[model samples]
Target: MLPAGLHWIERWLPGFTQRAQDLGAVLSGTATSITAFDGRLQAATHDDRHVLLMASRPFLEARIRERVTALPNVRVVRARAAGLVVREDEVRGVRHADGVVEADFVVDAMGRSSRLAEWLGDAGLEKPRLERLRNPINYATALFERPTPAADLDVAAAIAVYAQGLGATGLSVASLNAIEDDQWLVLVMGYGQERPGRTLAEFRAACSELPGVFAQAASGAPTRDIATYHQGESRRRDFTGLRHFPARLVGVGDSVASFNPAYGQGMSSAALQASCLSAYLTSGPDLSVPAEGFFDLQQVVVDAAWSVSTGGDTERLEAAAGIEPPEEVRRQRQVLRQLLEAGLVDPFVARALNDISYMLRHPAAMADPALLERAAAATSATPH
Candidate 1:
């Protein structure tokens, strides 16, 4: 099930495999008090290298804590940032539960509910205009121990089936995870036109309707009660255009933009943003350079994730209203549709699709002349 032509590429990137392993170790020690839960996981393959065989949030957090705790500059403080303490033209510090913590650089990793906007208001900075597109994505996900070894479960096979739904404008995926026990997280997802049910029984029925692999994976395995999450839309904060910004404060992760979770881009996007911020710090404290660079990098990350999530969103004809995509982005959408459809039968197309999904390749890779030609040829020969 490894997509054709991708194994070699994945061997180098290892896509999420190493990252997931690193994350698991850190989080295990960071959130040691709370019980680790398995709500959802991702399914991906990059160039057939098999990026991540299986991973869970608990594992990822443990990985992060183990690695990050050793860093002298990194502090795992248990408090929420309530506001920014800014003056005249720059940020002096951030206000947390304990009190304002003064720092030369402040990176907000506060997820979506960031207080940066209010803090910016305190500094004479214009709040980045926010545009939201509502798709009303809702789903009930549960974890179950796999009846067989996780090595027996195929991540690419599950994603290939999900890619088929993309052809019809729907989405579904079943992936393996290594928590306390080996397990497979089966998710039956519906987008605008194919959104899932709200109630537990309704969601269970939807799960039953998925490919036999899902039901088979869950069969006889102890299943947790379905937990539901509903995110109404995607929101992007326009930070790059702001001329007046605090010198010391910058936001990261979902604080900058929160995509529809169905695409599973949350953690990956956050990691990229964190890396960008880290990179900016090495250039010294110029403020303007890294601040602008931070937002610019964030926009790039958002654009990449938005392209895939919105392409999936568009299939939901009912949810398409009020969703205004930039007019210049036409080619990416067309290529994505082709990739999904082509991925149904062509392993090469699928490999390319996974690479793009995991942020391992630029969207332009989908437009390679040879790729387009193969996709076109595949579409002509294959019937939907």
Candidate 2:
């Protein structure tokens, strides 16, 4: 998880950070840095101001479940959600095989394939417009056992190698992370027809094309077979702009928006949305009305994540399809390219870019006039 998500978790569940560390979550020190390579030169961005926590999804989810079930007001129900129980333009409860479990409010956390829209249509409510970015991204992940006496490892906690300018290379992106249990989690991603194969040899061959750290990490004994997944698109359901919606019903996580998992923004985005819900509830809004205020707050979080994840994909996909984007879109892409070029050599620009990438700051932070001016100057001054 990113620092932003961890911050909210620590706030809501006191002592979560310490507990997670104790339970084998690898928390990077403040000195941790993320190294990025763009097929040619490399740059390292220091996370001196924030630390990221690297833990497997199961490990993190188990910890969350342990804490949440301990709450007196919450209960663990082992049942499938069949549908929503709506009455008088409000979500009154959930329908399951056994019966309906009523609630004053309902949160749809059923993930990317959430049936909330279908249920809403059944309830005579308008469905939110779904926006999709068709970028066929395929990725594979493999786990490796870390070498004994961990000090022998040469790589940092995180490394990202991009295939931006590499000509005709099947690979698009590759990364490695130092996780708990003295293991390394390596992932290789490709776009469209470039699929990362699901074999140890193929995984290592792909890593060999990447930087040295990836090769070194892949040399370790394989702990598991490579697992692969394909995402056809990044999607978001526009609930904020909806004119007709049910009251006391809200969506979070992938139910609201699902981005390219490569960006690692899903969990962090959901946590921020949960924080929005908390803020909305504390404000004592009338439950009889639609949760427009909550949606407004959630939209900001979604838009930031969506922009960060989709900006580059949109540009690349459009170019590959032989389609030119609008003038404004082209200009925005040019500005971002300048900022990235400047970030390679300018610490200030690097920090600002890293902050937005990690969701520590909003995407709007990139528009700071002073930052733009500095980036432009740095881009001009730096030797190509």
Candidate 3:
């Protein structure tokens, strides 16, 4: 369904991706958006990351439960988190309906609906400041399967929204992913467009503009009715920036930052966050008041993901706002656009870009003097 960084899998959860129905390489494309032509340069896959065909949500949840339940030190409690139990400025533990349970530290991984802000306020502490990019995007996803393979490429797919002027045009990108069980996960994305095709007919029309394989595979059999999901501006709660934070308390996953789901970084990013925590526990000094250093390290992790996800969505964000972005944003975007165009034609550039996409390589890899020199040269020589 998606490719994951090998670092997370090998270090944290070995054989996690093995539960997938199969393993496949991801294939992607970039298009001109409006014309619906597949003539743009094809994207290259990276060897470091792996494309996994995972089971559906329910099955994946069951697998997670099974593995976690077997751990001798783990206890699975299905209780609501009433709030935090703070003794003065220190976080003692978590409070539930039954009573109080204490711990050396507590990680609030309650996801996007995390009640951390409420708990912080209740404990007489200011909540973390939130930084947001209000693109107000929406997506409609549907599952369509075929009795047989009719697609030219049976991997993953992506469409890049074209820019008509200095800023992005008010259109969006769309995609269809080849999932396990011979099914395709169809997604129709809009920047501020909000409405994606809802009914089967509408969903088909949405797919009509996507790659042909999406339509052909989707036409065969109906796995389930079309489904829809909506997400507003991507948010990063600057927990690291909070001045009134307590020790022995931290957050992970969406609690720290909720990215645009379209990027598919939610699960993997959380895993990486957990990995960071592990590193801190093993090497860092004892936890005390103002773990600002740990939060600083976490910010580094979040910054990597934010750059990739937000950078990719530049067109949509600019388009939705209908304004020219800042000078720095424009300059970086133009450079990235050049690299993208160059990647379509050059394998090396493609590899570098793909690595950047998976967050396996720092974004600075795109700025390698040699690579940029080569890409600029390649762009000039080629016809636009």
Candidate 4:
């Protein structure tokens, strides 16, 4: 079961499913690669037992935009940015190609290509510090129709396969409504070590190279057009770590930190950050501590998401150097691996894993010795 509070994933998934159905579309495909800790290829394909949980990227983005724009206080703008304007160590506003937009407070929500820092530098404000993720990843995806028999099957229970070094990761997911119209969603993700092909024939060939489940799914589908998105590396700016920041401005969403899209934490992180900002803003004006409080809250969300993404990145042998997760994190991940492995076999465990994976529960809660002991007991009791 999903968590009680509404999450971006839940909200976006339904909107995407509805949009696809409206357009006579079915499932969307996503194949994400991973670097296993054991230094081996771990690729997954579309025909796997678990293809129902993934949705199309375009639909997902559209749904999120729809929800964000509906907020009374939120306004959406479509224009390229020119730069930021500041004076006397305080933020004045932002300048875009269309015109200058000034407000009592200004927020930079731009993604990885944020020009806020450069603008800060130009305005003589302190430059923000940057930390990049250890891995570089890319993605390609398409939609497909599921086989009649697979329709209505559980797609959320699907598992992904990660190939360590063979041109990114190969995996497939079946969206919530993909089976309603007999379709599925598939994505191929490229990791630091592996890069997947982009063209249709090449993508099919790459999927064929994966495990039987993925290959069968790719080979079985009557596919839609293909698309690609390049979002490499996870980046975080140390705004909280800075001693001085402009009082009249704040940065949120990808402007503050961006995770590898493969980790699927970007949207969730942004939601949490926005929630923090809302709370800070609702508390009324406090020029004395608004910026610091905002960053501190954002760091909590970023650190939680980064811990998981970076942990996985470090496992990839060809990952960028200079990032070595602490031993404690490594050990904790071992326990998580066991849970995931168990989840692959037990439906109950899968639900538990899903709950934690979606950030419905604290990561530390999963580490309870009782849960580990229960998992061990359950594993031993099962037939070989």
- Using lDDT as the measure, the top candidate is 2
Per residue, candidate 2 scores C-alpha lDDT tens digits across 1-384 of: 877888899899999878877766667643544556575433455665466777778888988889999999998788999998888888899999999999999999999999989988887899988999999998899988877433344454655646444622467777777776878889888888888757888888878877677788899998888889999999999887778898998999999999999888899999999999999999999999899999999999999999999998887787778888999888888888888888888878878887897799998898899999999999899888
lDDT of 3: 0.67
lDDT of each: 0.58, 0.83, 0.67, 0.59
On a 0 to 100 scale, what is the lDDT of residue 324 in model 3? 87
* Lowest lDDT block of 10, candidate 1: 28-37
Candidate 3 residue runs with Cα over 4 Å from true position: 1-6, 22-39, 43-55, 148-171, 312-315, 319-322
Better of 1 and 2 by lDDT: 2
Off by over 4 Å in 4: 1-55, 63-78, 145-157, 163-183, 205-217, 220-225, 228-232, 318-330, 345-349, 379-384
- Scored against the true structure, residue 265 in model 3 reaches a CA lDDT of 73
Model 2 accuracy (lDDT, Cα): 0.83
Local accuracy of candidate 4 as per-residue lDDT tens digits, 260-353: 6665667667867777887888877686443787778878777877766666666663233545667886677677777655554454555555
lDDT of 3 by residue, 128-187 (tens): 888887766767778776354423454454444434322122225566555556666666
By TM-score, the better pick of 1 and 4 is 1
Candidate 2 TM-score versus the reference: 0.95
TM-score rank order: 2, 3, 1, 4
Query: Which numbered prediction scores highest in TM-score against the true structure?
Result: 2
Ranking according to lDDT, highest score first: 2, 3, 4, 1
Number of the candidate with higher TM-score, 2 or 4: 2
Regions of candidate 2 where Cα sits further than 4 Å from its true position:
40-47, 148-154, 161-169
